[model samples]
Target: MSEEIGRVGGPKNVREALLISSETADRNRHEIYEFGPFRLEPAERKLSRGDEVVTLTPKVFDMLVMLVRHSGHLLEKDDLIRSLWPDSFVEEGNLSNNIFVLRKALGNDREYIETVPRRGYRFVGAVRQLPPTGRNAISGVLEGQIRDVPSRQTRRGWKILFAAAAALLLFAAVFILRRFRGENSASSPNSPHLAVEQRLTSNPSDVPVRAAAISADGKYLAYADPTGLYLSQISSGETRRWSLPKDFVVFPRSWYPDGAHLLVVRDPKHPLDSSLPNPSLYKLSILGGEPQKIMSNAWGGSVSPDGSRIAYLSHTNAGDLWIMDSDGANARKVVAGPDPNKGGAGQDLIWRVVWSPTGQHLAYIQAHYRNAPDPVEPISSLRIVDPDGGGASVVLEDARLGPVALWWGREDRILFSYREDPANAQRNYGVYSIRIDGRTGKAIGPPQAVTRAEGFIEGMNGTPDGKRLVLWRLRVPAQVFISDYDPGTRQWKEPRRLVLDANENLAWVWTADSKAVFFVSNRNGTWKLFKQAIDETSPEVLVEGPSISDPRLSADGTQVLYLSSSNPDDASFPAEVMSKPIAGGTPRVVIQGKGIGNFQCAMAPSTLCLFSRDGGDYVFRVFDLEHGAGRELLKLQHQVWSENGSWSLSSDGSKLAIFLDQHRIRFFSIATGAAQDVTVKDWPLQNGDWGANSQTVFMPSHSPAGVPVILEVDQTGKAKVVLQGKPNADFGWMIQSPDSRHAVLGEYIPTDNNAWILNDF
Candidate 1:
């Protein structure tokens, strides 16, 4: 019997029985099976309870089908495994895992599949099979019975049937109407507007606004634009600049409920010093008075709807949420951050906490630790919990990189800003809203996009009525400039703008001959590699694609290596390391993985190319371009922050410099798997690259007092300022020539950020 069951060709009687069973199953494939309120269709591979379809994995669905095929009969464990995973070997644990997942997908109907202890499983639920026209046949018989009886119950049934038919007709009509309107809106110019935005403050001097807030009554707006705090009245269109102490810098965070006082964060330490004063919260009055300190060590805070208590974020090992009385008393931690001692998984940092309208719940952002097997991407979730730290749950699990600003609006919805393309900084940021589940503190409906605007929406606030919104729009213009740096004199001179097209042009590298420069730009809508000679004004396109980044020229100057995304718009697309001839031809893929960034090749002495792949921690590899192979050299002890741009390769490609957390720099040798830490007096390093001698690294450092300076650090970590930026000017990434005599730096062109009020949002 076992042989007959397993063999394809068997005895005549057995073959006939098997063929009959197969034909019967095929004939009933499209038939609907009903058990209780659940319905299953074998042909569609779908299971539904009344109107909602339940999602299931492919294996689980197959297992459910097998169980239902043998309903009321106990199937042995081995038989079930053979039936489900017939072609491969699988552990009993996998079967059990699938059963568990299947039960979860079944929800309340999980009891239908009963586990027979020490043996197998059984589908105990009584199921009835129905033909294609079963419902219509039953309805026709009911109509005949009702006509024969002519009772009140029959009349009531007829009324219910008519009502349901009307409802179905109405729903179909509405769905068609919505589809028609959507199609027309895509092609029509006179479509209905969803939102109207108006710019509030236009500074003639082009000072970029940092943090902004609107008053509760929507009558006044306060913002910081590098200089100081400014207050503007919406009704009068008059602006007032408030004076501050010379040593203190204030960033407006939130406005007091009373509308007369604003909550601000102050930094009082000297900008050039290495040590900074702890950020403190204060109450600055709009009526012009000395600011009064409220909290000793807090940066962001939000007041309750009743203005009685405040929820604030305090800096510890990681940011944590805290609650305190309005007068700064009875402070306590509510949401604990990740512990430094506990290494993997649950470690998360909290940021951007905001209170619900009734102050019953607080929503914040949590960044989780990077896990292995997947690429190192920024993993964040929007979470909500009780103010006293209870009933916590994640509302949105895949929040992208941005400012993490969230505002609770009407109808229990939260509006937030996120970036769709983490690789392309030039892409527009979008705003989305998700409905909050009141009972479980989770998100209920799908997130709907409100708008996608150019640049970034840094800060957002809503009026008391939740009808008007104020947002800060920031656009930073980046351009490449060539300057001469003399390592001997430690002076920078004759800085000239290299690219004048006004789009973001960065990640510039010199060719082996130092005659031309190669960089990545998004001037043509998609990120592509472009090259131009040192003396030329125009750049020629080298490689054009939808998702290309981190361009590198090989040591022989014959090939250009870069990371290309199969689908740039899809975050799950794994990036591939591709190499193409510098002169131009078909590109060849070398390595395939996630989180591929920051690659370099030796200038002339060697043909080694170094690249880094990020999983949880960064793994650096050295690839021999000639042999088309590579090996891992070292892995970082900690995960590199994606936004920091922390790793750099030396010109000779012998040593790699990595800036790690806790103000530490690691100089790793490629030949030997040895690393040495470079100590720089606890100075925070932004971004830098190696000098021509390969012994010193030139990096940008900002002082505690917010002063930006270019520093040259030796192999031993001794550092000295090579170039000082203007007091308030922001310095971007810096790249140098092979001889260290010439370099190009990104100096941010001043951009004016204005606060806009969006009505009917």
Candidate 2:
């Protein structure tokens, strides 16, 4: 039977029969059956409830079959359209008309099928077969009835039957017209809370990380959504706004110094136009005004405390830091000739200038790409420099740390962290703080650490005019807290929990007013941006849309920009970043069509590679939530390949390490197009990522014993075993926390249905 089933390319007859019921002739039943308030007899090609006949067309009958067979599953509108008219093209309105007819046949019980917003309909109802009389008795009765009908028609009964038929037709004609009008009214464009939903795996939400950053005052939030940036208000969920121009691909990177404006980055013009510079930084006002371009050739930058100067990393292969005026003038080189002799020409790239709280000094991480002729790790370091390009020094040099993340306090102190390696082939970042200027450098807590674990440290304003400190801690479900400092004790107090169960992560930017946190959450399974008090219940959906990501609230919380997936039903989940108002209105698509399909995001938001317009090619696209467009940057022609293409990135977005050429692992630098081979022994390299510092890359190697091992290496071509063993440990998709303080591994126990996270060890 199994062989027969396989040969026939379908399930066995026994299984098929079991799926249905007995008594009904196998040949009499159609491919699909619908039995509910309305009994549709496909062989008779009629629909009826009890003795009352209901009129329907052949196409509508077929639609009923499709909906019933897959009852309780959301059926995409496109799928239904194809199923009904496989050989012929039909207008969308035709499908709608047929649905109206079907619903009329069902009468007031049309709720059996639910309409999901923006997608399709789902048949949700109870279905059961009718009890049968004795088989022979039923068959004999049906046969006699069939014979009687023919004989009666010959006995001059035509006149009476014709009169009845006329009345039935008249009733049906009026009923159908009314039903059509009713359906149109119900599906009005102005319907509130309407959303298209489908129970399909290939839909949106496949991407794991969806987050946004809110500023100190919490008045605005900045998000890097697949959609465009959005601004929502806390006082009254009344208005929502968008942030973007009509054509440019402008995504929100970070918030401005005052939260009164957003830091928007414009993506490269096009991949073919290599002359087009990388995304430049600009300041977009929350209240809406002309966007002031600050830097034209910078990838990532930050606003100085006074909001007068912008510190950014140049996108050129030379990789230098430059300080520019907020209005896009008076640019000065902050870091000159980083290994000038090397000419900054390699896969390894340095990053942005971070100004100290006092704005007196600047800091950045420098990369020294180690050419791994074989399986070797590269080395990198944290280099501090003056904003005027003076007094340069290397604060920390380590191959494993990757790119450094620096957090500045109001007291002119800089907090930096390093990770031992990328965790679990995914990313398990850890957290630790070191005082800049080579003073009081120590691991904050749980100092007895063998490896770095995942943690986060964000600047939260303290009481008494920003004299105190508030920091945020994030794992899978992120939370916030206030970090109390004791100068005499030289330690941070146990933090106070601010908000719990953040759903996903922050998706909106903080407002300059410091009163609320705006973000998007799918707690209800639909991505919508919201804003709430810092300690209030989580935010609510600010706008109505399908699959929104990368939401950045304008500094004043008046506008929002985000990338929204319009057609989640598409296999590729084709999306266009859109912009709307905080007050909520029609959203305009800023970035039109480009990518061929959806690419799973394995890297952090820093460096993302989506499917390019050209098949088999990938382009670095910055999803501008503010601008509602994804602009292409660097284009690569098949440099890396993956069946699933699951890979990871450096914290600073400089490098990408993925399984290349199938079994062997490879590392590719985003800046220099440098590719190298990594030494992967007995275990095949499945998934991995670069350390926080970007120099070292970690790949998961599973031994013959079925134990997963983390292979670690240094630039000197030295290799060593870091963490190995544990056949049951599924760390293939873990990630190192941003601060490099902790690593989270995916632990799945098949026996007990246990699949959960293991935090910092």
Candidate 3:
């Protein structure tokens, strides 16, 4: 079974590696097939209905042959794509277009091609395989039937013999053509194009997939999980843990030409840590033992085509490109991040550096975000350059380009992940490919999507044989649940899901009257704001069309406020902070700004609204309910990560609680400009928010076991666990009503990735 085309050596080897599909190969009985009024000739590559030849395009003809060959059986779309386009992958739309054209040519009166919905297409018509008409069959049938030989034995014998000789010659020619060109044979179900996908592991979110790589021979798979690094037999699914020195976390990155050793990434920090430091590159033997350190603080050292040198990234982001020997010796900088003077956007983020198939050029993705701190409006460019630091040029560049990773595949092709649908990129991330001219090292045409599915294809590695692909899809599946706070018991009631649907959901704050909760969900594909009443089972859609998030009530409690944009990840879109009257009215823009990180508002009569934007550093802005624009409040010069520098407005609109660090919190008085610092006991806090009374703060952190925990910090620096979520769940945010009668908690769901082996993809 062929799987990965990206792993193959060259186009010459690719063409020879793929042959007549098994399904059609074994059925090539040197015969003609017939169905209804149509007669199909395999060796002739022609279809005729009562002598009327049905003209068909080459690709369309190929599609019809496969469907007719596997009549009544579903031909998977992936398999068909592989068969039709053996070298380059295209979007499913291309396959649909071919099918539509084929149907039209086949006279669509009867449902010849049946689409199985999300699956593949099937040919429902009955088919008959007619035996080959040879010289022997013709002589045998007619020789006995013709009793009267026109009263001349010599003439009759000569005619029969001549006919037999011509039939024999024709049969021999047909047999030879079928062997070389595959005639009308379609790819068999077992062909690489139709390779079946197999899941190798069923691990949960806690033991997420670290990394995976397929061997060149397509016989073994090297991967890393929470347990440890493992080597698995592809055919038997027999996986064995590799015994190595403990303490450091490790993940398999790529394979060496020898296949006995693998390039691995070793991180000294704990794998379960929320934030991990940079990892060092290492070379580990599959035979087991200690891994040898290759280079420190580097990435991408996969074996070059000739197994001489490697191109690696000096840093993870905005890093210089460097090439080093195979044994980690004689390392030197080959290329640095894009220059700022040459119309370059600051430092170019170098991602997924790979050596071209022939070791002629090095391919890499240069990317930059409009807002660096928060990574908004990502502009990615696929560029390649000579390893000697010459012949540098951009192959493809797009403002909305966000590929999971890029890989130079077989046949001078590069495979990368990108979203097809711009509106809802969350579920549309798929693998795409583009062919490169071997001589010029330039793209031949626009990129085409090869694989499309839900979740993110975080990692992909194909076998060198171009027959198998290793897929690692990552997903963070979460749902919203309401946990009521009981002042009587000073505890939270058992949480009940806010929305019954299975889609991911998150709640920010309750409605003005506290009778309902406004939350964001991707139930209809894109993230939208919806209000769910506690008394009702269904939620009402409050905002749709544009992507919206962070649903909160205005400080005066008379309006609903949310951040809406065309593309959430893109900071250039300029998110509009909109508000609508709770009693029902068109939403009006309060303020719009590019690179808005997040926004929040205090309870009724407080009029304390704050929004943060991340261009390079974090900047805070404040606005009132009646104001159309906001005034800059505070500008943070220091870089803020996911957790550090978290802030929240107080319910009384008198102060702001901000996390100066993991263990420190600062409360700034709004009017007097007074500040008070308080220290907490939590070792690491993601963020902190002000409570209803404005005197206490809640800090969110995760336990080592991956459970979400919230810490309640008092003015005296004392802390206690207020709310802890279930296992494999995240604590999104915490919100309390102004009355303090009840509280709403956002519990994030488990997130995990699956390792799959797709044959012949």
Candidate of highest lDDT: 1
Cα distance off (Å), candidate 3, residue 509 = 1.6
What is the TM-score of each predicted model, taking all chains together?
0.69, 0.34, 0.70
Candidates 1 and 2 compared by lDDT, better number: 1
What is candidate 2's lDDT per residue for 309-336, written digit by digit as tens? 8877776644677888878789887765
Rank by TM-score (best first): 3, 1, 2
Worst 10 residues of 2 by lDDT: 1-10
lDDT over C-alpha atoms for residue 279 of model 3: 74
State each candidate's clash count: 2, 86, 13
Better of 2 and 3 by lDDT: 3
CA error at residue 612 for candidate 1, angstroms: 2.6
What ranges in model 2 sit over 4 Å off?
Answer: 1-213, 232-241, 269-277, 337-343, 373-378, 410-413, 420-427, 437-761
